[model samples]
Target: MKLIKGTLVALTCAAMLMGCESKKKETSSIDVKDAEVSKNLVLDLSVDKVKNTLGTLKEADSFPRNITKGQKDWNLVGVRDWCSGFWPGVLWYAYELSDDPEIKAGAEKFTAPLKEIAYTPADNHDVGFMVYCSYGNGYRLTGNEEYKTVMLAAADTLATLYNPKVGTILSWPVMVDKIGYNTIIDNMMNLELLFWAAKNGGDKSLYDIADSHAQKSMEHLVRPDYSIYHVALFDEKTGEFTKGITHQGYADESMWARGQGWGIYGFALSYRETGKEEYLDTSIKLADHFIERLPEDGVPYWDFDDPKIPNAPKDASAASLVACGMLELADQVKDNALKVKYTQAAKDLMAKLESKAYFSGDTNQALLLHSTGHLPHNSEIDVPIIYADYYFMEALVRLKKLEDKIAMQ
Candidate 1:
């Protein structure tokens, strides 16, 4: 895969994690103007790609999930599907970057259907994913009062699943009988909704709920080596720790790439909202492990211990999530060396993602390709998944903000 010469050199330095101060200085000398031009070009292309994908949809209520093998269009899902919010989130990001009227209208059209999810009592913890990602971003960008109302109600609905005994949100209520009170690493991502609601006239206790969940996740989900388990089980009656297991990963002992991504992003976000040093430390540790284990290309395999090694399917979704997470982590870090390390790592991952190897480029309606979702279920493997595109676009937006900040400096 081709990468910019400067980016390639910086990535090589980052990968070695040794004495490369001179190399880092040299790569840092690249012109800010050139970086801005490249970033804007990618953002424009992403906006166009989102618009094109909207054209392919026959129903306004349908959401793009993934494009399966041999399929030219997206596999559509209903509003209740776990992935339903990502497409609208993608459109919101596209509009944020481009400010195009057509993209804004599309974002509104798609985000409207998700309002039902806010009021509906959900048995699962994905209400945050289903509502916050769509309406949260919409409310942020547009300040629509209706969007705010829907998000508050969704936050309330999500609060119902938080088990006080477990000190965490129950991720899958249906699985509680079979596996006890199960909380996946992915649930950490949903805490942002609760955090937001507590600040936005919903309920003050929502913040405590989110904080408790993050604290509990840090206590149980993170391993000693900083690698994260996909699922952490707790006894329903006493809230005692049961065990850590895997649902979508290669094995119970393996570090699932996306699960690690969730931990990195979730803790970084928790640190951002609460200014907890332990959360920042956890994010850094998880990020360090993730970066150290990455393949030569900077993107990661679906699972670190999948045993397929050189032949494993790549998960661009995980890379996208980590890129955004590392960028956020960089913003919050006071250590110059660690900040520079994370910033460079994020750039390296984004460079790899923008390459011809991963960018969809008219091959499909999505922005990215080769994301593995539920590989054990034989589902959505090596496909262009919607969340990958959403986070990829969000990472670009974050990168652009960083560049603008540097240019001003």
Candidate 2:
């Protein structure tokens, strides 16, 4: 009995020591290291370029056009940024990288008008992307309840704005006798906001709607070629696919760069959430086409084969968006070769944009310049855009990962 008691005491002491050692181990929040970041290529786009751009322009209630010294064609469509769901998102990404007070201040300029967006009786599914990426992400990083209040209000607005009977979130409000556009591939990108709302709002049904639309997107929006259709019509009652088309693509027939980027990124996220092979497969297939179409410089034309239209300079912004998507794609694929190829493709595109269109010897906007947004409609025809800035920074993060892998090798 004495011997047994001694052994038990010894074991207890050893176990306590082991537990202490385990607890003593240092905890790292994130393993990502920038040491692998390519030495000659770093500009700290978050800090330097954004500081320069913001220096040139003030946060107007509206977007500034023809407003900056470098701006082309002095026309203030100012709505393009809003169309991408306005300020918070772009600034959210901005602050995440820089932790800049200026970016936070900049985010507020759009909030008042954007609050109206959440409350507006129209079905612009992008409010989540527009507002949450900024306000929600901001609150998450900082733990400020004010941002949460803004998001809650936004969710209420989105809930009111939601068309429940349609079984999908309508993107744009009805414009005079227009069929409410209940389904668009772009909404796939917007669903993240709904998922977030469900999380924060305690509304499980909100996520159900978001999930249903995503399933529909996979079912009806993707073609056999794995090229995604831009729009699909659904029966409001049944959620059945009634019809689908390519509204934003060239001639309703070709792939649009930004839309494709949305598809790849959205599908990749879906896979990340569900770990489903189909989503992963779909992401890989679309990614394959995106990679195959890259110009020698790794930047893509707005449309992959845009008929070589005369006087059409390239859309470097589109290239940047695709590059950002490819970087995410690199993370999803399990195959080593696919991972290296996608990551390298993204890095090569970044190198090209940085060297060619994105960089200026003295200018601080080192990510990209002269991007053409919606040339056919003549919107933001040729200007640097915020999404381009966001994507460019995201690519750099991925590039940093690639660099780390290279260092490890």
Candidate 3:
């Protein structure tokens, strides 16, 4: 029943791509707002920082992971790292913005090391994170057949982790707990690669796999209030849902801000691929939930439902991801009021990201600062993560397109 077939599905995808392409074209008649002008200034600064970072990394043989505060050096890691693709992805975004030859070359060079991981990913279900972000962006921006082939192989590898019975991709092969089938809300972001492959050149079963995972996540991981749990455990043999717990949140019951961000982006992307009304509705709910919990500056505490609220660490990555999803959701909705509400919210979030509180000053190598990776382990509590930078740049790219689209209208 999940199977969507033949020319109709293909044509629908084509129309969506065409609409996206049309929005990228610039228009001179549309007046740019003063707030947007300020946003543009921040984006330009970000691009320069990226260029300088890449320039410094040109001598390195590997990709950057993250930087500690007041550190001039970037920590290096192999392609096996979950965050490997983000640097290349950020480079690709820079090229899309400036079309600089050096930036394009850097993007390709950094992507070269990741090609092997597409075929030989570890048992974790993050090939989407490792391959899709790098080569996926490569294929989208450059139309390189090589990138497409690598990404399709990665999609196949990711599919192998899919538990049809459990209806979600396995996030980690081994966890501290002995659960045979473990899934996370972060897995939702991985489905975009599957949907892309299915619509473009891969099997329709890919779409079904992604859809099933989304359906299951909605059933078990999302709370009635729209906050998401970090992890959902299931019996591998029977697909019976067991328990919902938090591996990275403040507590088992707390609302992890980044988990909600993942849900928002994942569901908005699902709506985009399938035109499913339910997906859009759920995305809106998740976005609203996150927005309602934001502090006055719009950046969220690491966990929305945490006890140390006012003193909690800020997660700029969550804000960046939510902003990107909200912009996409704003475009897809038919209700003008909803569209405006989401659009302004996205702009506010972006503005907060550019502010002195969250924005790492010009001296830092990282673009956005104060991201929380794993709070429970006392690891990466407050730092600049590569994924945070990648999403922030991506949100800027999306905001520009939305601005151009609105101007034309």
Across 1-409, the per-residue lDDT of candidate 3 in tens digits comes to 0111232344345445555667663321011112233325566656666877898885333788778777866777777788889999999998887677888899999998888877884578788988889999999999999999988888888998887778888898877266557899999999998999898888889999999998899889998989898899899889999889988898878899889989988998888888888888999999988888788867888998778878889898888888888888887889999999998988898877777667764447887879998888988878888889999999888887877777999
Q: What does candidate 1's lDDT look like per residue over 310-387, in tens digits? A: 898999999999999999899889999999999999999988888768877657677898999999999888998989
Pairs with backbone N, CA or C atoms under 3 Å apart (clashes), candidate 1 = none
TM-score winner between candidates 2 and 3? 3
Best by TM-score: 1
Writing each residue's lDDT as its tens digit, candidate 2 over 1-409 gives 1122343344345445555667763211010012222233233434444555555555454543321336332233342344444334555555555566776676555544555555554455667766665666567667777667767666666655455665566666652145434567777766666667677854777767676666767888787777777777766566566666665567555777777778887887777655778878888888888777766656666666478743445666666777877787788899999988888877777766676345432342434565667667766555666566556666665576567678999
Task: For each candidate, give its TM-score against the true structure.
Answer: 0.90, 0.76, 0.89
The CA lDDT at 275 in model 2 is: 73
Better of 1 and 3 by TM-score: 1
Task: Decide which is better by TM-score, 1 or 2.
Answer: 1
Q: Cα RMSD (Å) between model 1 and the true structure?
A: 8.2
Q: Please count the clashing residue pairs in each candidate, in the order shown.
A: 0, 1, 0
Clashing pairs in 2: 88-134
